[model samples]
Target: MILINRLRTVLAVTAVIVAPSGGTVLAAPSVPAPVSAAAQPTAPITLRYEANRRSMLAAGIDRPDGDFLLFDPNGRGRVAQVFGDLSTARRIAVLVPGMTNRLANFWRGVGGKSYRSPAVQAADLQRAGAGSGGFAVIAWLGYDTPQGFDEAGRANLARAGAAELERFVAGLVAVRPRATIALLGHSYGSVVIGHAAPRLPPQVTDIAVFGSAGMGVDDVAGLGTGARVWAGQSDQDWVRWVPAARLFGLGHGAKPAGPGFGARVFATADVHDHDHYLSPGTDSLAALARIAGDLP
Candidate 1:
């Protein structure tokens, strides 16, 4: 009951008792439950995205370029960086990058690299839909990506990273339950998504793999999610040469960009090499923006 009703009853009882005679007086009753939705946490879990953002900037662990959705201080640092307004967004785009990505370079693009950093890519995707209040692009470097090309040949990191990826998706769903989520996994990250696909929430509507070595699955149907699967390839991407076989656990199975991978090989113009899919004005980037915005 409301506190006012309880106080009124207490006053009535006190009037009939010795309270009027200066004997025993009743104390104010306590409130049972908080009335506002902001009570405790807004959701089942308190992501504290805003708190973490401020903390990272103050400590120099992150930059002022974008917001931090989730951040880990230990070691090389795992993070989820947001490029647009996530709380009010209708669509969400998650960018899971490939090898050699760490907290230090999460936003800083490396010099002479074949592709742009995850941060730049995410920003580009966000700007693509700025007219319609586009998706909240997230650069999720939440796993220990392989340090080099040689270490990337195996699927060990992807196998171990799958659980965390699934949890991250669940957390996003908790915060934006009605938002349409799209997953974009580059290189070895594809294998991580492949393993996590079976357990992904229903809110996820699309999964795209580009410059992937392999997804560790024979076909898109094998991933077990209802989301549409897409693969983008460029003429210069060296990942095409990576063996599509997972024999003896040496590599991820079934190349996603290959002809028989069973994913939609959608429009990919200006495709240069591995990691160039996010280049501005590229067909792949445009298509990706559409997928995230749920636009045709």
Candidate 2:
């Protein structure tokens, strides 16, 4: 029975990779060029935020509920919303989401659930770290994310996202040279972080992933980053059932939260499922906040 289940899992994952629509194979989209480091230092963070906000307004896009440092409505859409004043922040956290996210549901979430909304999750993290002082959080939807299980089973989208994420962090580091930064990713976002890790700047002090299937690597050393690595997975997460194996570029590889992956494991007992890791008052959120705020 166990062997039959394992085989079914493999076949199902393979089907997604080869023919996500059940009849047609889809080609990966072209990755955009990384943001140039030269362009970032030209403007302060505040100026950038205002300029993007103005652009969004002019484009007739509805006003964002909070400050946005970056916004583009083209294609699958991209945005980076800030939770606090970036200019005065000494510590910053960038939260990356997983599959099925786009501008259409960036604010309200997939089904209007606060826990799944990137903006709400960032706000929650910001509030969790409010006492830490000089802290800010950015809900970063800077890449074209995979829309379903078919794309999620592959690494092409993740590679493209990694390039974009690397550049976004570079811009942040350029603007706030002295600020400590943390990268937090959930689910397939963790795969993006795994690919971006080796290229990220030293100012990024930590990387945390929750409810992850894998980071597209064998272990922390495979990430090739000097920053500390953290992982969390609730027993209730369905991702635990995903095969932690990489085959023919199909799976994402070993789970980061599992033993032997070399990440500092954190408790997620309060998290009820994959989407609840960043929910308010969860132990996972508190731990992530501490990492982002540079608290012990």
Candidate 3:
């Protein structure tokens, strides 16, 4: 009976969150299903970096082999890093991760702990953007995110983080004057991006969201920035089921693949869950490349 109950819970969770888009979305699910065994939680990861105008490398840290600086901003494990073969790129991309996520999650390319993190996702976008031959990818893993089902009330952590993100962009602009940015946000990160959009400068070329709930907008103009807004969601993304009416109250909503939200709805063909967007050779990656590449 206990096993049956667990199965039921898993199904309920899956059905409530995953989308029904079918094969267009990668079938892999981001969250694990319920298990009978008690799951042990790991120590929460943390990090911080005191960013300054000029060079991130000047801050003093072991820079990754890639032509960018990688630093543990808070020394808690969270990372804030940037990537671009300056010799071959002119555009810059900023990637934001979701809940309970840290810096290490971005570079776990495929298997290791970092396999599906924003770093890995940014790398995928980097390669795709490389087709255009002049782009940089930034892994902005700074700020403290409310883990689990944290919502509004005592503190709007997402809103606060978005403001910090805006500052990061400003700092990046001051340092790399030639670089224009495309902010790519996933899951709860979309909320941060949405709230911060009102404060962004005109240099932001594109704003893209994947597996997002609602983006806190009634239309594109509400985004408050001139960047082209783009959205992509796998058919099986559970986030699609979060009703818009309930999203504002719960800090989530059902942002659909249609007009009015004011974004260019990309083709999510051959993709399925929230996390699959980082997978190499997927259509999602291809679309991301096209959009990022085409940005003026």
Q: Check candidate 1 and list the clashing pairs.
A: 237-274
Tens digits of per-residue lDDT for model 3 on 1-296? Answer: 88867766666445423322111222226434432110101101111121121122443434433433333334334455555653345687788777667543446532354546667677777777776477778777766665656553113767777877887777666555666778888777777888899888777888888877766666677778888889998888777666664433564433735565768888776777767876777888888877766643
Q: Candidate 2, 113: how far from true, in Å?
A: 1.7
Per-residue lDDT of model 2, residues 122-235, tens digit only: 999998986747899999998889999989999999999999898888888877889989999999999999999999999998999999999999999999999999999999
Deviation (Å) of 192 in candidate 1? 1.3
Q: What is the descending lDDT order?
A: 2, 1, 3
Best by TM-score: 2
Q: What is the lDDT of residue 33 in candidate 2?
A: 29
TM-score of each: 0.80, 0.85, 0.70
Error of 2 at 3 (Å): 79
**Candidate 2: clashing pairs of residues:** none
Number of the predicted model whose lDDT against the real structure is largest: 2
